[model samples]
Target: MAEPSLKRLQYFIALAEHGKFQLAADAVNISQPALSAELKRLEDFVGKPLFHRSPVTKLTAAGEALLPYAKSAVGAAHRFNEYAAAVNTGAPTSISIGTVATFLHRGLPQTITDFSAAHPDILVTTEEATSAAQSDMLLGHDIDIACGHMPLQHPGVICTPAARESFWLCAPTGSPITTIAEAVDSPFVIFRKSASPIYHDTVVGICRTHGFEPQIHHRTASWSAAVEMVAHGLGVSLVPSPVARNYHGDERLIFTRIGTRPNAPQAWITVRREDQSTLIGDLALGLVIASEALADPVAD
Candidate 1:
């Protein structure tokens, strides 16, 4: 029998992980029948049934034996392709960068445009993702790089300190916000618990520490919508100053200094530290430079 193809090995791995034919097909982005046929062909080559289908799918003795090899084979194949691409220089010339929504207004667009212009041959794709999701993307190789405040602690991932941004209060222009007390009384627009738990918890915890729970009138991921809601007198918010800076010069928005939390979270650029790719390194450096240029805090 001929050696199993890389695609078949990948299907086997995915099926083993998922343990359901249709689910694995969905994950591999192939039709169920196609995935089933491929698995059968692989089993026939191995001369044993790989899976015993029942109420819950069970791996046959041969299947159990091959599971680890399947994973190792797929991972090795992936690394081989990456190595080959690095050597060939004809690999897909693109970079995927992920960041939370707030960064898009000021930080990402210019950085991406500048990088694209400098390296016209390499395509740069921007993805808007939550802080938690960004780490996963970098781990799964779904995105080449990520820009955000949260630290990158994932194994096999490396984080370089990109920039430091102070937190500020967002409200109507000239609105009085002498302290966290006054800020809490206003209509508050907050990021949902899912967006950035650290930031959200910090803000809420600070408010609680100050002796009152904030009255959150709106929760959203859209900074623009939050700004709009704040503009129409809906509520106030505590956001990274860099994001507030983007809305500077707008008559409807006001930014004030937060008396409680002065030091901002460190904005970071996360990537696979082992990444030897020239293009990914260049893009990560560009982000670090851009962040440093935008670090002024609100005047007290």
Candidate 2:
């Protein structure tokens, strides 16, 4: 019997994900005819059709049986390739980090540039992930570090005090929001109800404490979209203070304090098993230094 081809396994997995032969072929950088031929070859080798084709794809029992093994085989091949590249070409030491969209405007770009300049041999990749996704990334080793608001508790992670991020009520420029109650009454453009569990709950709790539920006129997953919605007078929003700084001088948006008694939760930098790399250690230290710069001065 002929040995199973790694390429065939990869193609199968892609087909499963995309659920379309032509699309999967495009994704894998091959022609549709080539993809179909390869799938036919694999099916013949195993003496079974892997998929039941239709207007929409559906997996056969054989396909379902093969899927997990295919994923593992593909994953191992990727790991092997990464290891070979890192060993042979001496690729820059790398770290994957996760942060919120808000930091995409404030500190993240500068920090990444400075880190690269200081360590030209190290590669840094940034991913915009929600707090929960960030936690999942760290635990799964998909990322070396995650910089976002505190994620729920996990046993093998170390969370550092990154920064105290705040939230503010934002409205269209020149719109009067002289009263906290007025801010609460306005139609709101809210972040996704699933964005952050704590923040979502906090917003609901705060509204109840204020004796009124916000009139949520729109819900969005994109921060820029939410800001644009506010700017267009679709609704006001409660957004992170760092993001507020970006729109602070915008002629189309106005940001006001969220009451003195209440503030948004802090952001933390969480790391998985810390012994992974020297470069990650350095990056973590630099984040601490940057966080200190942003901190309020406290007298000793």
Q: All predictions: root-mean-square deviation over Cα? A: 5.8, 6.0
What lDDT tens digits, residue by residue, belong to model 2 across residues 219-283? 88766888999889897877665667777788998787665323444567777544335567668
Model 2, residue 284: displacement in angstroms? 3.2
Predicted structure 1: lDDT: 0.75
In TM-score terms, candidate 2 sits at: 0.66
lDDT score of residue 192 within candidate 1: 75
Give me candidate 1's TM-score against the actual structure.
Answer: 0.71
Identify the leading candidate in terms of lDDT: 1
Q: What are the clash counts of all predictions, listed in order?
A: 2, 0
Model 2 misplacement above 4 A: 1-89, 150-153, 261-266, 274-277, 288-292, 295-300
Q: Ten-residue segment with the worst summed lDDT in candidate 1?
A: 257-266
Clashes by residue pair, model 2: none
- Per-residue CA lDDT of model 1 for 55-162, tens digit only, reads 787788998777756665565456568758856986546788898766664367899998888888778898988777787667656677888758878556678776
Would you list the C-alpha lDDT of every candidate in the order shown? 0.75, 0.73
Q: Candidate 2, which ten residues in sequence have the lowest lDDT sum?
A: 291-300
